[model samples]
Target: MASSTITPASLPPAGQTSNFVDPPYIGGKFVAVNCIFLPLAVIALGVRTWTRLFVVRSFRWDDYLMIIALLLSCVLTGVTLEMLNWGLGKHMWDVPLADFMAQFPKLNLIAAIIYCAATGFTKVSVLVFYLRIFPSRNFHIAVWTIVFIAAGYSIASILANIFSCNPIAKSWDLTITTGSCMNRPVFYFANAGLGIFTDFATVAVPIPWLRRLQMPARQKVAVGVILAMGCFVGIVSCIRLGSLYTLLKSTDLTWATTDALMWCTIELNLGIFGGCVTAIRPFVRRYFPRLLGLSSGGGYTSSQSRSRKHGHPLGSIPHSDRVNFTNQDNQYTTTLTTLRGAPDNGSEEHILASHPSGHAKDADGTTGIIRTVEFDVENSSTAPQRE
Candidate 1:
């Protein structure tokens, strides 16, 4: 029997696959899971974009960048994984996914590059948003500075992933029959360190910036919660670090590294999601009906949300009640009233006396004064009777 000689066209040795790897799924649960995740993310990307277009009335460049990046990354990662699977003769869980993934480090580069590119851009967009929205210059500087550092790390990552070797091909293909390359360990270690820093910076930048927002206390905290979403970013970075060996040596690190890649994808998507959340927060207050409260049916407004605690939703003050009928003082008043009371047949003095002190009519009928000693009850007893 002829031995299956290895060639780029021929599949790798059967059952010699790595258990897990990075950036792309190899087979089994990895393939099934990614099949689900990619479609879901695609669906989410579309739904989120459309929802923002009509409901929020706008979508930012970051949104477009993130959606496009996610799509490209997902498609590349998925297609590459499928091709690798076919190359390996649909190798199953007999070996690690890393064994297969290691076969094409170039694909790894592509996957990680797209993931990092989207994430880096998303973070920068978030920092820009913070700069625009936050009142504190310190917050702006802090966020931008972190973004600057992240940008540096991202650039390092790009260069490292691309040119760490004399010729870039060596980083991906061991059988290139070409120039010698840098040690894989050295490249991966540096990658791990840089990734940790980028992930950390991505997590850290939003805090001070979000905390500095002039929103309500709860909302300020909510804004700060955006940074907390980085928990997944850190998780993926750390997990990949722990599995760095597989990321480096394994051929099919699909399941292991693909999870990491997917996490990174989600992290960037979440950042874009956070932007949408922040931008429409005020709009939510403006247009959305408060589920648990009453309104003059004019719908919710910023003032109603401000006055009422969140345990209850919003209630609007009627337009007539928003201002005082008589401007005795420059205070805001919300008392609904009717102008039903007219001059009685009593003496002009007594008829005039029926009106409250500030209720005296002006020439234009728009403004009035009241000078009456007695008044009829109206909508609420506290509300002045309408004349």
Candidate 2:
């Protein structure tokens, strides 16, 4: 084997050097974190795909976006593990300078770009999910705004990282010192700051709507917590910020950034986890119905699946109900009535049926199911009688 070309001057600065012979190889921690989280995220994604593709049977844009996020995350994981071979988690001075110069900067650059894209896609996937469920125009606008901001930040961050050094190749080549590079510390700080903002935005946007749901308070909180899993990723991002600052400021690049890199890997995996979790309600509702307070055969069924099996359009009355109304007057009156005076279970959907004059209208007509009724009046002067 050829001898390494590393020189004494090429080593990390004396201030960053340690005297310990086997200075802690923290690569195991990084590896362990990735080993644990990536598989969990992948499992979550797998369950999500099963839920959306087979159980819920309503695969859509958000699902596709999450798939992309997971793919990028896998790539990022591979890159990080590869960087470990080049002394990523050891003290800088402990590493052969030739090895450090050969690969670390280049791999770090690729990881940054991958992280941005992965996280962005994950957030947008969750936002698109909001678009699917919430018909509120204001909520849609808010979701779209966050989507654009996340996407734009990803694009901008990727561009900034790619062109951090003027001559592009200068990013990996420390020997070429003539080229101008962006203030990377400042750029990173800004990127992390904006990313945290979007994280909070994603976690907060659906809260108001969730609180307004008619479900019990406990279930609502559970749902909110599940959907807001990204907040934990945000919290991880916050913690990663400190590590990032340490790496940016320290002379010990390899050792100082290990924790930050680990957190970065974790953040992306958790983003994948969060993006896939909320959609797994169908899976839980199917296999573990008790968790959702539903019976063995009963849980959430998408309108599409219902339509396919029952042959009725979404929001339209079924054939069985249609037969009962054929003999009534052509004039039909539609009114919204509450579930009050009726049995109230923990069901998620409420059906409103039209009735005679005494029934009150719902405050929000768009919510719940609406049933139309036809009235036949035998005598105009008398009070209406039930058929």
Candidate 3:
């Protein structure tokens, strides 16, 4: 077997000394950050899954998609860490040429594919969540459009990465010496641009609907903040774009790509965090009411109070009697009259009427009133009776 070697002539140009031997290898930095972040991402997704399946019992499409995204993110992190052992995050020339050719491009290509899938699925999960909450036709159309765009971008990016080099093995095996690749930096920048666009779209699609929700000011703000959490993902994507630019411009491929990889990891994890945050609210409401300052009795919504007040002892209620009141001071009135034939056996006639006033407090601690009416009639004679 021939030993691999690099001569002085093979070194990067002047002012690119960082591509050669340098002190302070930073491969461990990727490992350390992944250790801290990957677990947190998994924990966030786990809590969300538990909350959806058990606490709320309303697990839907979004939850499953998010789980897929989490699994992909796990794969991405594992691949990224594996690459560190193969000379990622070091000066390029410091790596044995054979090891570099054998590992970096192949692992990077796999990571990029996983990255696109994970990000695309995450956006789908968020948009699916929005579809569940907002039923307007326009909102549904908008969300589906974005989902399609994300899917398209993911497919395009994966194909671009896979075919970036001819005789695909040449992508990783530089010694092949007879193949060509696409303009990699241009392809990377385009991919990053698409990622940033999708991130912004994911955050933007819900803002108008959030603003129109009829809720107390504090509740509105809380909902807005949660929905807007994707903004952090967008910010990280922008930073990742800058890192990609740096990686493209520098001859220190390993060192320059380190920042890009780090930012990508952060962006994906933050996206997972953002997706889980909304679903975890119910769990928080149940287990940590004080954390959100919610009353143990329940929220201030009138529907909840009405259900509590009028629900049957046998857990049945006349659906026809349901009322929705938008104004606290608004008064509603309903009357029921009933006629009955004489009972088979002699019995006394009876009539019962009840009026109840219910109080519901707003999230801001202001109180409101709800009124209820009930009536019951019993027949008394052995023979039939006519009005």
Evaluate all candidate structures by whole-model CA lDDT and list the values in order.
0.50, 0.74, 0.71
Best by TM-score: 2
lDDT of 3 by residue, 190-271 (tens): 9989888988998888888877777655556667777577887898899999989988888777777788888889989889
Question: How high a TM-score does candidate 1 get?
Answer: 0.58
Predicted candidate 1 versus true structure: per-residue lDDT over 240-314, tens digit per residue: 665665557655343345544544444444545554444444333334424212232322222323343112111
The 10-residue segment with the lowest total lDDT in model 3: 339-348
In model 1, what lDDT does residue 152 have? 77
Q: For model 2, where is the 10-residue window of minimal lDDT?
A: 308-317
Q: Spell out the clash pairs found in candidate 3.
A: none
Error of 1 at 241 (Å): 2.0
Query: TM-scores, in order shown?
Result: 0.58, 0.75, 0.74
Candidate 2 residue-wise lDDT, 1-387, digit = tens? 112444421354545554234656889999899999999999999999988766665679999999999999999999999998876888776777777888998998898889888988998998998897788999999999999999999999999999999798898888888879997766877898898999989998988887676765555666867756877888999998888888778877788778888988888888888888877776776678677566665523322232221122222223344433334333222323234323222124545545555453333332333332223322344434659
